[model samples]
Target: MRILRTDIQILRAIAVLSVLVFHFDLPGLQKGFLGVDIFFVISGYLMSRVIIDEMDAGRFSPAAFYFRRARRLLPAAMAMFAVVTAVVPFALTMGALHDYVQQLLGALAFGANLVLWAQSGYFDGQATLKPLLHTWSLALEEQYYFVLPLALALIGRRWRAAGLVGLLVASLLACQWWLRRDPSGAFYLLPTRAWELLLGSVCALPGLSARLPHREGRSSIGFDSGWLWLPIMAWCLLRGVDSVHPRTDALLVCLSTAGLILQPSAMLQSTRPWMRPLQWIGDVSYSLYLVHWPLIALAKNIWLQKVPDTVLWALLGLSFVLAQLSYQHVEQRYRNLPTPRALLRQMVWLLVPLLLAMGALALHMHMHNHSQAGGVAQGQQPVYGFDARCDQEGDFEPLPACMNTPRPHTMVWGDSYAMHLIPALQASPPDGGVIQATRSACGPSLDMARQSPQDPPDRGQRCIQFNRSVLAYLRQHPEIDVVVLSGRWQYYLDDPVVDARGRFIHPGQHEIAASFARVVQQLKAMHKRVVLVSPPVLLGPDVDLGLCGQRAAQGLLTVMRTLQTHCAFERSLWETRQAKVNAMLTDAGQLADIDMIALDAFNCDDRHCVTVMDGVPLYRDFGHFSQDGARLLGLRMKLGQKLRASAR
Candidate 1:
């Protein structure tokens, strides 16, 4: 029976394409990362088949298995790494380059997952710029390879299948539990990810394979099965990108993939004319995955620019050209080279890392020393003034810093937007100093998490707990009279909630309005004053205000803004974006004890909202205040006077 499965190759094409589309930010293709999970399943299927067949023949060798893996994987990876290391200095800030060094080293050592988990989240915007960010899955798979062969060897012939099942169940349950606690860990680490791989491994067992397909070249249940399976796979890939994976969505993808593997159709055959394109993509899949992200990342880093459709398409084209070359020159050659050429290639691989490391170190040190101000050092990511104690993710319980003052009359409560207000409040304190009860993305609204379209869904659920914590504080503290509610309210309005069935549901305007009104009335019952900070003038979602401001400082912002498709929002777009929440807040302010504060009144003109005023960058990326901007706005608005006033 030939092991070069056409079905597996086609699956590889689908998976890699999903990832490419996702990274490219092509509209309606958000769930492209599901490709990685599919890859893990494919790897497990093939690896299990190899180890099991070898063990059956009494010829299983761990060294040989690993050698095959390295030959297949490392040549393209090392080539990509060398090119990326060269791009690092020119493309990244010292702050980013510091993390890049670790990422590069982690790729070299096959531990990128651990390094990535400790630094940032997979869904985080910053992660897209790191060229080796994609390597985490590769590292994870290699780690699995190390353990799987030995694990099967130890389990013995009769019990091996049972052992694998036990592992799959345990790992999956652990993954589900851990996602609520540490989603980054659940995502990047092997413990939570093993189940998906184990699922395929179990399928590859002799008893299971016998029940599955019955033969090598043909499948028992063919054409109709492929039709049913392919659509399900596509649906899973497009469903919800923010659903924490190895979760329900990924399980669906994996199940669909497994179904196809066990019951592939005639169309999957390489001999079919239409299947040729998929076959070619699959053949170059490894190299495509290796090269695609770095090209996009480098372009972004080089210009600190967002990907326009033209740029995204351009990068995709370049990635294909480079991927084809890498596949031909390196991937195909390294494995089958003559002994002399193989030895020379090994020496080159060994020598390249040292040279790359030395060069990266020199550049990193030079940049770190000299990059005191400006350039891509400041990008679009949010910047906050307060320590992490008050504003955090996960559980709502906070440290001492959360309560800004021991006995405070005023309370600033909301999401990161509320956190930005801290500096302003500090600049002008109310009679009873403020106590903060805020969580990241957990707005002070009674319900409805401030879910970002791109952020993981668990944050929205945790946002419920965070809001309750704000209420609990209000109940315990009778002295606090003023309650300031704030957030990027547009997020909750625009960001759809992912329901139980993996469906995206927009909580209707009435539901959101009721939530704010309910919270306002509840505070009124407690005899506390309510301040609803109107969503401020925004520079649209794509503009990095700080970066834009930096360019403005150099008199280049006008030119920069003209080039950007989404960076600057016209007054019309801005008003429409905020119209719903603005209506609700206006009505809320008319109530007995509620007051609404609109910062845009002072910041915006008839034409547009100003990003920088008096040479201070008013807002951070998208729409949070930079530290100085908050203080400036506070002083300009005379916020302390309004906040300290007794009940209206």
Candidate 2:
């Protein structure tokens, strides 16, 4: 109804800045994700106000409203999409480019959130490589736009206020429930995000706005009471806890923002000298938001070859310049053009860019696919395979040749990370030694576990069956001399312990020690040499080798070193868990009379765990070793000598 207010502009700046700092890996900005919630609320309030005003005057036009939205959202999005599509082929590996192309198509179709949700559920590292990872917000907003108008039309004038409020509350509750059950899905999908916008929708209703007092001076609330809400909001932003439960924190931020919007006081207003630039940035906020991320990613990549802080700042400055110019020349001109005719022109303009983007994305995918096919033909490395049993059971089966062949002199088996070690194993094969393996998504343990928190009862049955099949395979493979067991083990250490029925047991009480000990005992009875490989040190929960390389190039040596040190220190948790399991193994080993190889010292020194050893990353992610890292580790352990001698 009104052009953007100074306060609203100020809020926009806050939102964008929070996100920028978060993306830059600045401390205390981890909660910057809340900025998307702020944007959703603002979008709801503004769009609802316009729709209500137009509908009351009997001049509402869905076609015109949607056209305006498309013009506002699609052009810059397609621009970013086009740029990313063109650059990805040259910048990313073939496997990475294929994933990016899929993400691009999903973003273009406004279903990026769903694609991301499904991908996240699969436990793949592909999520980190997606350039359009931010499109989940746009998808949520588009989904809201699709439903909100028809909802307003149906309720009519008399009952609309109560109906809308009721719907908003119901949706909010539903989202809360769903988040607790399937947080990964809730985090990325549209339905779980609808309530945040609806809260803003309810606030925009005519009578609701009128009910609040329009005081000339600030309402008589004291300084303590007035300022308390700020820290309460800030605390929610700073605290980083496990998001296992439904997020009540988002609602807290949303409600606090609603309060600030409804009753702006002197304190809430931005009058400080510093606030001016942020406010200015807020003015062209939409363009700034669209352009910043891809630029940052590109800068990170280009400078990764040889980075300096000056270069980073220069790239940031370049991005700002490009954003401002785009805002002034492109966005401003189109947004202010006359209606209907402007709408038609905007549609044509938007469609051309989208089509071009789609074309570029397709080309990128084609090249990537061809590259991967060639790599496979040349026997570079195979990252994926199909298991016959997995196909029959409607699950990801074990690789067909993963474990069924005649037992080799040595065998390495576990997850994808372990699979990546195949190249290194092949490179340094012991004379007269043969190695075979089975690798899959689940950890090396054959214990029954759920794929997801929302997994049905059938999953338990499936896991039990799978474990039995694995046990039988192991029983039949007695000739496999050295069983090198490895996996992304750290992921399992903190998992909630459960009983056979999958009911949670008390913390620090449920034990898997005996079960693990028995598996070791079984292997020992078969006269298989057991080498329990420990997890590598991790820098963070998720790892991006490209990002790490960029940081290293930038001469952020302290940061990189600290990350490696922290990861090495954190590996003690795994060691502690291993101590308990190993004690059990020690007792079992005495009775079975077998040798247990401990390889924890392979990647660690007294005070640090080095991610880069001899100029190679020890890990692809936080805990799993990269191919190069694994090879280096294998070499350090004298794997070839030990395996060949054991076979003899």
**TM-score of every candidate:** 0.81, 0.70
Residues 1-648 of candidate 1: C-alpha lDDT, one tens digit per residue: 126777788889999999998888887766888999899888888889889988988998887777777777887888888777776665554445667788888888999999999887421345665777889999999999999999998998889889999999999999988876677788899999999898889878986763433224546653446778788888888885345666888888888888777776555664768878899999999999999988877666544557567878988999999999999988887766545456466749646775766586666656555543333233333444356667666556535666666687788878777887888877776676777777776666655665453455466666776677678778877898888888766666676654323345577666666677888888888888777787677645655555455444333323243323323446766677667877766655665346677878757778666766776556555567767677777788777776656334
lDDT of 2 by residue, 1-648 (tens): 344556667767777777766665557866877777778887888788879878989998998788778767776676667666766545554444555666777887888887777667433544434567788788878888988899999999888888888887787777777665566776776667777888788777885642333232353453422365556557666773434323666887777666656555445454789777877888777777777777655544433323356655665677678778878766776675567676567657656765676687667556544642323111212332222222223232334454333345566655554554454555466544444344344444445343444443344345445444555655676666676655544334444434345555432212343444455666667776666543444433534432353223222332332244322334564445355444544553354344444445776665544555554545444445555565776577766565445431
Local distance difference test scores for all models: 0.72, 0.58
Q: Look at candidate 2 and give me any clashing residue pairs.
A: 390-397
Misplaced by over 4 Å in model 2 are: 1-3, 126-128, 210-228, 240-246, 270-274, 299-315, 340-385, 388-484, 491-515, 522-648
lDDT accuracy of residue 59 in candidate 1: 95
